[model samples]
Target: MTYQEKKSIVSLISAILIFGSFCLYMYPQYPEGGLGSAETFRYWGSFVLILTVVSIVAHIIISIIFNIVFRMTTKEKEPKFMDELDKLIDLKANRNSFFVFIIGFLLAMSSLIIYQPSQMMFIILIASGFISDVMGSVTKLYHYRRGV
Candidate 1:
């Protein structure tokens, strides 16, 4: 695979793993009374901070390992830099990703208006951002594979 393709795949996987892990961690802790409870809100607020730190650290470690493996497997003596086409593809992918983010943001805002739970809104915002990143990477990988 090309470097860009590999990078996108890594990013996609990272996003999925991070999000899934976060969900798994929080699922059992989810309040039976939902997010409206003050105790639940406090719990989620602290958990979100912890999750953010964990996700960031995990992604960094995964990225380092992926880069090392990629370098070891590839035959290229030097890493390839992004050309105009690559740049264009990235821009297009980001544009599409931005739309996804906007939609997610709208949904989060709507949820806040309906439920009036700041904690739920925060979680939704984080989830939406993660989904947006995953979509962006997927778009980039698709473009690379399709030679767009």
Candidate 2:
């Protein structure tokens, strides 16, 4: 297991855990108002905003911790620079992540066009964001393991 592979696995697991725990914590607080009520919009808006902040902070913390642990356990410092292969893999991962998110975005918009409840659009958008994150991690892990 190389460093990149281990880091990718950690990222993948952390993404899942963070998203799951956040969703569980927020589920009960969902507004009980009518689907398109102002309160409902406020709740969903806060949900996305807070989730974005929390996820960014959690990922940064996890990455730092992972680097520290890797150094302590393996006596190896983190890579000092990204070479061509690293850059390519990262680009591929980002491409796939954005692709998935764009598809989700289109679907969410279509839900609105079809006159679906606004809540449905929010749900779809949020789910796509989560899935795109997971997809990026998965892509990195796969590329690291299987060769770029």
Candidate 3:
């Protein structure tokens, strides 16, 4: 497969891992309220948040490394852009990311306004919104045959 195809596959896998994290988190809460005490909540919440952040940051760093490795292995200069398809491919990732972020931001604010979700939920929502923005770009790239 091409580098772009490989990159998008890895990103999709990362998104799935994140979605898995969300699932693991929700499983405990399914029976009813999440635990009894505030202290218990704090510990678990912090644990999950730290783990999620670390996982995502690690994914990004590793992805950058993978791209570098692939480039080095291929020993070819990266593709240059002078044509219409190149320009479109170059801009599509950023354009879609920005659009998703703006929309997610608006949605998050409206969600907070109407539902008044807890502080933790607000934080998670914000994090997930950003994740969704990135996923949007990755998904677009997959369809458009662009690399990260």
Best by lDDT: 2
Any runs in candidate 1 off by more than 4 Å, and if so which? Answer: 32-34, 77-80, 115-120
Candidate 2: global Cα-lDDT? 0.96
Cα lDDT listed for each candidate? 0.82, 0.96, 0.62
What is the lDDT for 92 in model 2? 99
The candidate with the higher TM-score, 1 or 2, is: 2
Collision count of model 3: 0
**Which is better, 2 or 3, measured by lDDT?**
2
Off by over 4 Å in 3: 22-52, 64-90, 119-134, 146-148
Query: Can you write out model 3's per-residue Cα lDDT over 7-93, one digit (the tens) per residue?
Result: 666676776666567657755753334545575566557655766686679688868777787789988644443456545654776
**Sort by lDDT, best first: what order?**
2, 1, 3
Q: CA lDDT of 122 in candidate 3?
A: 44
Pairs of residues at least 3 apart in sequence or in different chains that clash in candidate 2: none
Count of clashes, each model? 0, 0, 0
* TM-scores for all predictions: 0.81, 0.98, 0.55
What does candidate 1 score on TM?
0.81
